[model samples]
Target: MMPVDANVKKIIAQPLTAEAFQKYGQVVSVPRGDDGQSANNNTAKRFNFLGNVQNLRSDAKANMCVFRCQPVAMPFHMRMLEKHQYSNQMFSPMNAQRYLVIVSLGGDEPDLQTLAAFVADGTQAINYNAGCWHHPMIALDTTIDFTCFVHENGTKDDCTVTQTKEQFFVHI
Candidate 1:
């Protein structure tokens, strides 16, 4: 296997915009609460994309919620691998599902070549250009309204899951 440093690739900084946005739709700005209100930690930061409410569970759901991720390397002097987590099921329509991610808080810029590996051509998403890799999905937290595309052929694909154990330390 390649050395730890060899496997680690510099994360490219990308943004979620009409030009960069792969999925076409009426964009809804998920209002983020106060800056200081967001809990911060070494592992990652958590936030409620929407307002909280009470709801109940039921049979399986058929809906989709997608978001974008970006690389923010300016916070770190050295680039690190982007880590992520995922679940076996999808939560949509009427279920409270949630996913958390640690963006590349690093205050630096990544090269275009690095970003070449990560791109969504046609998908509904809110890009998070943190550069750092993050969990694919944690699923629902509470019932929420979401809409997105679904690959019906069942041959859905993502570039690939290149797993690695890379820890990042963010100083507040």
Candidate 2:
């Protein structure tokens, strides 16, 4: 862990909306009505190609993972932010539960002043663009399971973590 800075920023979580979240990534939610039919003859709502699922180098490969995350209480202090330089990351909730999504513009490093927070219901998921800075999983209310997609290889280039000079607290 890094040393905490003297500055603290308070962030109020707002309702997640497609328009607001577009800059960071796509908001993946089940579309209304049946858009397509799967081979099983069931109604299917597909959100395709939400993000760039590729490795930074040709030698690496992308993989899918299931994460069971415990819920974090409100007024949680955010100490660090991370980004995947190689591939885009996607998170889809396996259960219907509300959660918090915090993000900042992608760059060589994270800018605390640009941090934004959004509250997402179980119906909503997100595909963070490559290099997008974001806080780690922040499940709320109850424990939740998420299906994650990203490049996986034993390399430090996969993810980068930066400690903030100023602390931020997320409130719902």
List where candidate 2 sits over 4 angstroms from the true fold: 1-6, 32-39, 42-54
TM-score of each candidate? 0.25, 0.87
How much does each candidate deviate from the true structure in C-alpha RMSD?
14.9, 3.1
Could you give me the TM-score of model 1 versus the true structure?
0.25
Misplaced by over 4 Å in model 1 are 1-4, 21-146, 153-172
- In candidate 2, position 37 carries an lDDT of 39
Q: Residue by residue across 1-172, what tens digits does model 1's lDDT show? A: 2234554544443333334322211212333464423455545445343221211222223334553323333322232333211111221222323322223222132222323222221222333321223334222233234343321212222212343334222221
TM-score, cand. 2: 0.87
lDDT of 2 by residue, 4-88 (tens): 4556678998999888998888788765563643644455445455455556777667788988989987788888999988788
User: What local distance difference test score does each model get?
Assistant: 0.29, 0.83
What lDDT does candidate 1 reach at residue 62?
31
